[model samples]
Target: MDIHYRADIKGGLLILHPAMGIVISGKVTIGKNLTLVGGNVIGFSTGINNPFIIGNNCSLGANAVIIGPIILEDEIKIGASACVIKNCINKGVTLVGVPAKEINKA
Candidate 1:
């Protein structure tokens, strides 16, 4: 796995699937129990040093991409192949689809 992350992760990080290409930027701040399924990319595409913040107990599904300047609050679930370019600050919300809209709140 080519996991390249130069950031701060507060607690545990779990990658569920056995795959390659995990890229996280240096400007990211991840909290506890960051459960990731399969390959994911968390970075800013604009080349600006925008901070990507993932709160505690968050789960990202396989092949998820978070292209930010965005903040995800605690206990959020991102579905497979979701592309989140905006912020999801509501805690315990489930996000899915290409632009990753909120499906429901848990």
Candidate 2:
């Protein structure tokens, strides 16, 4: 399991096992205690100057793709195989599926 992170992390970051392939670009900024399940990609530049931001205590599942210049608030959970291309305005929410939509965990 090889994990490559070239971003600015404010605190601790844990990339879990079974990490098939993980890549974090240099244009991203992550908060404290980020739990990455593996096989995930964060912030791959596509000529976009906006920086990708991740909040504290966030968990990104396996095969999760969070690209572009977007902001994810604190305590967010991104499900496996999820592709997020937008900003997560609310804090402490769960996002899943392609294009990544916020779901209510009832």
Candidate 3:
């Protein structure tokens, strides 16, 4: 999907099929092979005042939420029902939990 300067998308990079429902807000950058479901939201957590940035090759699971200026590196994988509300991550890693922690390496 493509989100411009002030638009909102459910997720950054969702699948081409109907299953990947991508919703985003503000300035976000997405990658490849991302899959999402309905009701998924990726937007600015700071009440539409903050601009966000997401990295490449990342996958946000069903109902996954990404907020803040999150810079996810290449090949970053987020599990279903996960929420990210902070900093950034490296390349080739799996993130889970409420704050989206790195569980495994790629």
Relative to the true structure, candidate 2 has a C-alpha RMSD (angstroms) of 2.1
Error of 3 at 37 (Å): 3.8
lDDT of model 2, residue 103: 96
lDDT of each: 0.85, 0.84, 0.66
Model 1 lDDT per residue over 1-106, tens place: 5454678888798887756557777778899999888788887667666567999999888898888778899999999899998889899999999999999999
Error of 1 at 4 (Å): 4.0
Better of 1 and 2 by TM-score: 1
TM-score of each model, paired residue for residue: 0.89, 0.88, 0.70
What is candidate 2's lDDT per residue for 1-106, written digit by digit as tens?
Answer: 4334567888788888653777787778899999888888886658788768899999999899998689999999999999999999798999999989999642
Q: In model 1, which runs have C-alpha deviations exceeding 4 angstroms? A: 47-50
lDDT-best of 1 and 3:
1
